[model samples]
Target: MIRCDAHMHTRFSEDSDASVHSMLDAAIERGMEAVCITDHLDKDFPQTPDFPAGAFLFDLGNYFQRLTQLKEEYQKKLEVRIGVEIGLQPHLGEYYKELTEKYPFDFVIGSVHLIHGQDPYYRGFFEGRSDEEAYHEAFEVTIENLKKINSFDSLGHLDYVVRYGTHQAEEYSYRKYADEIDEILKHLISHGKGLEMNMAGMKYGLGFPNPHPDVIRRYRELGGEIVTIGADAHRPEHVAFDFDKAGEILISCGFSYYAEFKGRKPIFKRIVP
Candidate 1:
């Protein structure tokens, strides 16, 4: 089996505490074959009460230098890919593409963590926005960003807004949202991109799997072949959280293969059912 944590963060990311070395050490102990240090790269919304006003943004200069050194040091032990998890915001479109072009990252995971300029990490990001509006904005922002930045390798968590929305899956399944979701999935497939199976939802008490398994199956049905599974793990214990479940979900979704990345290209491995 291939053991990889494609969505890991280090101290370079505002939300994480572990250093790259410490994370690599822990992954090594657990026999991880590959891991990517995907720190957040959100330029706007840099003001967090805990971290200073300018603290939430990524400083590409030092981040690239440090990741370059670590990749060399760990090359003998495991394949290390340098990456970033960019927050897909509409206004910052050009800036993100410029950053990617300037950096030497091997993989890029674009995400929609903020809706209408506020984050779910804060208490009132959704106070004024209706749940429908929030969900709609989430989809709109994702499509807008994808259209602007085709440099990314994959899209993160298709239905992540459900995690914080007022409405749960009580009425809509991923299947029910097929018209919209299929449009997104087809876009990914057409552009030679993929979606990530973010297992973090389960750990966060979202009550369902990430991207919802039903969506995973639909992606398969729509010729969406590439998928990279991640815990979105911020700490050691969560490195492979629900990965077994992730594999099972893929199998049930009719996926005979799962993927890993190196040098910005996906490498698929057959899933033994």
Candidate 2:
């Protein structure tokens, strides 16, 4: 019944301040069966003048230690899966492959948070580009990354750019980038990878899940079955946010099951009414 929130950030992620214990408490309080700690691991993240190089990157040694402790501490109350959200850039495919191969993570979410070394979250990314151009570029880059990388279990937040788009995803839809989106889905299906139903869009004021229901429907139509639901929460309160609505969206998209991962393999759970 979609009991697992598979994508969440903790203090290990530079942008997140939520502690591992706090996130676990929140998930348990919400009656969650499991919550995976998918901290960010953006290799070769572009450096900003204000910060030191690789600020978004975490110390893998410390992260694994914390994860081991958390799993032991929360074993009885909730399931804690070790996961990572690797920022997928065009040039870092081999690096990520080596990193994931070295780590024993339960799942890996390959995300395109950066486009052409610029994060779409800031206004400057859309300063001169048309909404169409921005969105299309994001999709095109994602398709390229997917074609090149075979390391992640699911693609995180397919329409992540929309949250920060100048138009606020007001007119974004599957029709606008259907060809590109379809190609991305086809690659995922062919590689046994999945898509993530990221609920962060609602919190980010997009009023919909990332990739929207139309996109999810198209993925299902293209024989894509594995879809993981995540709050994309960076804080305790945001964990599992808008999940009920997410489930409704999946049901509407004709998805009878949602996926959860273990040892990088998908475990589908039926959606119960």
RMSD of each: 2.1, 1.2
Query: Each model's TM-score, in the order given?
Result: 0.91, 0.97
Clashes of 1: 0
- Among these predictions, the greatest lDDT belongs to 2
Could you tell me the TM-score of candidate 2? Answer: 0.97
Lowest summed lDDT across 10 adjacent residues in model 1 is found at 167-176
> Candidate 1: which stretches are off by over 4 Å?
46-54
Across residues 33-140, which tens digit of lDDT does each residue of candidate 2 receive? 998889998887766654456778888888988899989988999999999999998888789989999989999999998899888877778988988899999999
- Candidate 1 pairs with clashing backbones: none
User: For all candidates, what are the clash counts?
Assistant: 0, 0
Model 2 alpha-carbon drift over 4 Å, by segment? 48-51
Give a tens-digit lDDT track for model 1, residues 1-273.
438878888888888988788888877876678888888877776565566665557678888788888889999997788888888877877787788888878789988877767676665766887766666677777777777777678888888888877665544576556667777888999999978988888886875567888888888988989998777777777776766666777888988898877778998988764
